[model samples]
Target: MNAYGINPDPSEITEITPAVDGVESIPLPLYGYNVSAGFPSPADDFIEEYLDLNQLLVKHREATFFVRVSGCSMTGAGIYSGDILIVDRSLDPAHGKIVIAVVSGELTVKRLVMRNGRAILRSENPNYPDIPAGDELRVWGVVTSVIHKV
Candidate 1:
C-alpha cells in the first residue's frame, strides 16, 4: 500500500513477464513533501521514510507476475502498450476489476464484469468489442498496479 496515499500520474508497479522474477529490496529516501509542478517551495531536509518500491507494489510476492501490455484495449484506463502490469494470482477476480484472462488460447487484459450470471471481458477502448468469457475463460490473475513510464 502507498504510505502517504499519494497517487502518481499513472501508478506504481512492476514485473517482467515470460520469466518469473523477484523485485529487489531497494529502499530509497522518500521526502514527506509533495513535489510541486508549478511554483517551487522550501525543501524539507528530513527524510520521512525509506520506501521500498518492491514491497509497496507487490502484495503477494510468490503469486504475483509482471505482464507487459501488448495493445491499446485498456488505454482509457491509463494502461498502454509496453507498460508493465503487476498481477496477483492470490487475489480473487471481482467485478469492475482489471484482469488477465486467457481467451481463445490468447492472453488479453480487460476489465471483468458480471452481467446476469454471465462474465464479460470489457475493453476500455471503444474500438475493441466486449468478449464474452465463458468456457474458455481462465483468469491468470487480477491487476494490482500499473507501471507506466514517462
Candidate 2:
C-alpha cells in the first residue's frame, strides 16, 4: 500500500494499457514511507493519532499508481521534487483535476482548466506561466492524490 491509500499490484488494477508515446515510465512506491528507524517520541501525537497500526493496513483490490515528481514548478501546490504523486486513473478527469499531461512533447503536471474551446494548464505558482493545450495535448492521467514529507 502507498501513502495515498493505494495498492500497487498489477493484478489489483482493472485498468491497464500499453505506454503512450513520449511518456517516461515512472515507478510507484508501493511500500510505506519511513524516514527514521526508531519510533517517534511520545510528545509527537501526529503519528499516533493519525497513523495507528489499524489505519496503516489496506485492502488489495483498490486502484492506485505512483509517480515521482520532478522540478519545482508545482511548489505552490505543495508538490516538490522527489515527492510521490498518487494517480488514480479510475477517477474521471474533471475541471481542476491536478493532472499529469503530455503537452507538445513534454511531460507536465498541472491543474486542468477548460474554457472557450481551449484547454489551459495552470500552474499553482504565479512565477510559472500557464500553458494552452490544443489538439496535440494529451491528458495522461488525473492526479487523484499527492504524497509528500513534511
Candidate 3:
C-alpha cells in the first residue's frame, strides 16, 4: 500500500547519477516534472550555482545501493511507500536497527528485535504482524537513509 496514496509504476525507480568523481551511479527518482507544461527556467547563474557539486555536504561517493519502498508497513517510521532507501551493506546490522532482510526467499524491511533466544522482525505499523525467525532469514543490510519526494 502507498502511504502517500500515490501508486507510481515500478519502472519509475530508475537511478540518477550524482555529478561527483568516483561515485558509483545509484538510482534516484526523476525530480523534474511539468517542464513541458511551460515551467519557467531559473536564471542561468542560479541553476549553475545550485548544480555545482562542490557546494554539497554529502558526496555521492558515500552511497552504496539504493532500494525503493513499496508498502505502508514502515510508514510510522517515516519510511513511506515510494521512498528510496540508501543501504550500506558494509555496515553491520545490530539490534534495534532498521534493516532489510530476506526470509524464505522474500525481501522485507523491519526493525530487528532480539529477545531471549529468538529474533522478531517488528514492523513500524502495528497493523502488520511481527515476523518470527521460523523461516530461513538472512540480514541483507542496514538502512542508512530514506530519501523521499517532497
Candidate 4:
C-alpha cells in the first residue's frame, strides 16, 4: 500500500512540468523573530531580510523537482492532498524515507521499508495495505520536504 493506504490508479497521477517562462525566482522577507504559536511576543516586529526559498529548499537544482500530492494516503506522514512535495533524485532512497516511485508504470509516493529482505511500500495511513516492491518497481526520488499552505 502506498502512503494513502491504497493503490493509486495510473490515471490519478499527474506530472508537473517546470515553469519555463521568464519567471526566475521568488524571494520573500524572512522575519528575525521567531513567531510563537502560543502567546504573543514583542519580537514579531523584526525583519531579517529577503530570503530566497530556492536556496533553502533546493540543495541540488538539477535533481530537484516539485510534485503536487493528489491523495490522502500520506496524511499520516503529514503529507496531505494539495501539498507540494520537494523530491530529490540525487538522494539515496534509504529505508524509512519517503520516496516517489513507479510501480508497473504507475507513479506513487510512499515510505520505503524493508521486510524479510524484500522492499515494501508502506502507506502512512492505517486504512491502506502494504505493497510489495516487485520487479517492476523503480525508485524515482526521495522526498525531502512537503509544502502546505494554511
Instruction: Give per-candidate clash totals.
Output: 0, 0, 3, 8
Which of 3 and 4 is ahead in lDDT?
Answer: 4
| Model 3 CA deviation exceeding 4 Å by range | 1-21, 24-63
Clashing pairs in 3: 15-27, 15-28, 16-28
* Candidate 2: clashing residue pairs, number: 0
Task: Note the Cα lDDT for every prediction shown.
Answer: 0.74, 0.59, 0.64, 0.77
On the 0 to 100 scale, the lDDT of residue 82 in model 1 is 84
The alpha-carbon deviation from the true structure for residue 68 of candidate 2, after best TM-score superposition, in angstroms, is 0.8
Better of 1 and 2 by TM-score: 1
lDDT of 4 by residue, 1-150 (tens): 443345553322365544233546888867777666753453536657878777788888778888887777778899887788888889999889999988777778899998878889888887767778777788999989888999
- Which residue pairs does candidate 2 place in steric collision? none
Per-residue lDDT tens digits for candidate 2, residues 1-150, read: 422233321112123333233444343323233548774444433332334221232111144456777667777888777777666555676788888776655556888988886788777867666777666577777775566887
Rank ordering of all candidates by lDDT, starting from the highest: 4, 1, 3, 2
Superposition-based RMSD of candidate 3 using all C-alpha atoms, in angstroms: 9.6
> Higher lDDT: candidate 2 or 3?
3
Candidate number with greatest lDDT: 4
Relative to the true structure, candidate 1 reaches a TM of 0.81
Lowest-sum lDDT 10-residue window in model 1:
1-10
lDDT value for model 4: 0.77
Question: Which wins on TM-score, candidate 2 or candidate 3?
Answer: 3
